[model samples]
Target: MNHDSYDDNYIRGILNGVKSIAMVGASPVNVRPSYFAFKYLAQRGYDMIPVNPGHVGKSLLGKPFVASLSDIGRPVDMIDIFRNSSHIMPVVDEALTLSPLPKVIWMQLGARDDAAAERAEAAGLKVVMNRCPKIEYGRLSSEISWMGVNSRTLSSKRAPIPTQGMRLSLNRTSVGGGATTASDRAAKNRSEPT
Candidate 1:
């Protein structure tokens, strides 16, 4: 996988597949980008575990913070690294220690370590560098358009109105349209037979 530029499916697949995330360098401060990202993912129904040595015993969005990835005590589908480029390798090395390795190692915006990414990929983990999952999720789900940004996702069909909040669906025929909010999907699930 090209860590420099990721295909939409590559990102979408990772986002859709990952059920739980251990966010390293997560902050308790509400204004921090990591906090915002964590909150958004939690609201979207992803199990978010906060990891930060300094903030251990505290909580971010009510999720208790662990000192490190090893302390999570549960399997996480992805490791979202919120630290700077220089700190990425240590985090990646630590994440690699888990028995069932995470499916992805995602470096936040402005954070990139080619060596670290290469190692993770060689270990059979997908890698994303210098990108923010929050922003990508918003853009890919067309929720960013609500913020007046041109999401570059155009469609002739109208998007399904969200049932609550500003949440949109990751399942789509294209990037912008098809599936609606999570609540709507849940309603459909409740109505359908197994």
Candidate 2:
């Protein structure tokens, strides 16, 4: 449970387990890392809820943005923090107020708060600090290796690429809860008027 270093299995477990994620500090600007991460995770099948006070009532990736974590009506398996290190404590405080309480607290790259992490862990939430879920997912699933990026996973056989192209398929069986598969969601999106 060290905040400084996390095992691959621990990171993989979180990326695989969470079905729905409430992304705090999500941005509407495409240039921001949060925006890219939000889009990437959504495309991969996880139901992503955007939580940003300024963008409340706006839509991101087809999902309405909420003012806070409590505004989300359903249970969120993970709360991905994209805020500054100094802001993490309040974010963690807000996450703890949820009814079911998120299963995990993930702090994005360059965002770290040992004190906040400790508080979240003490409250029984699995904590992953200073790691980006998008990066971890790509690395663990071998999707990045296909992009000629070093995913750091070694294997003789290449991971199967989706016939549709570079789009990665969601591991529906590995997804926790009864969340809808990414394929199904993509199909729905396509069938919609857009």
Candidate 3:
């Protein structure tokens, strides 16, 4: 099926079922989007393995940081990439080699490599590019407030906050940004034609 056919509901289902995720390029700095995204996922009860060579042997959000996907020595439901386009291939390659293979390879916003994504898709893995799983989750599940400005107002005389920010806005209600929000990431499990 075409990429456009894989809608928010489908992605959300996948996210809901995933129990663990390998966060490639996860950073120790809390200010980084990846760090917060990983933290958010962890808070939501998903096991998050931080993958960063420099931070190997350390931990983020209490999960050990591995140098690579294989270093995790266990099955990972997904590989959530936070690296740049230029650095994504190796991660995809490694993810492809995993025994069970990852159910999904999610490229964070501003990070897309057509070749790498094609490889993953060709290997029978679900691939999402340039979309934040977190944003979609919030919108599809009504976890975040998306009521836009109208004659009605939540507070007296104040305008509604437009769902715009570091996250890419989809459908005027769903906002995706930074490393993709936890809610958006959870949206990755929706079942549709892939």
Per-residue lDDT tens digits for candidate 2, residues 23-118, read 999999999999999998887878899999999878997899999998898999999999988999999998999999899999988778888989
- Judged by lDDT relative to the true structure, which candidate is superior, 2 or 3? 2
Distance from true position, residue 52, model 2, in Å? 0.3
TM-score of 1: 0.84
lDDT for 174 in candidate 3 is: 28
In TM-score terms, candidate 3 sits at 0.72
The C-alpha stretches of model 2 lying farther than 4 A from their native spots are 163-194
lDDT of 2 at 120: 91
Quick one: how many clashes does candidate 1 have? 0
Once superposed on the true structure, which residue ranges of model 3 sit more than 4 Å away at CA? 1-6, 146-194
- Model 3 agreement with the true structure over 4-91: per-residue lDDT tens digits: 2255545765776677888898999989888878776675567778999998778887788889898889899999999987999999
Q: How many residue pairs clash in each candidate?
A: 0, 0, 25
Which structure is stronger by lDDT: 1 or 3? 1
In terms of lDDT, the poorest run of 10 residues in model 1 is: 175-184
Q: Give the distance in Å from residue 140's predicted Cα in candidate 2 to where it truly belongs.
A: 1.0
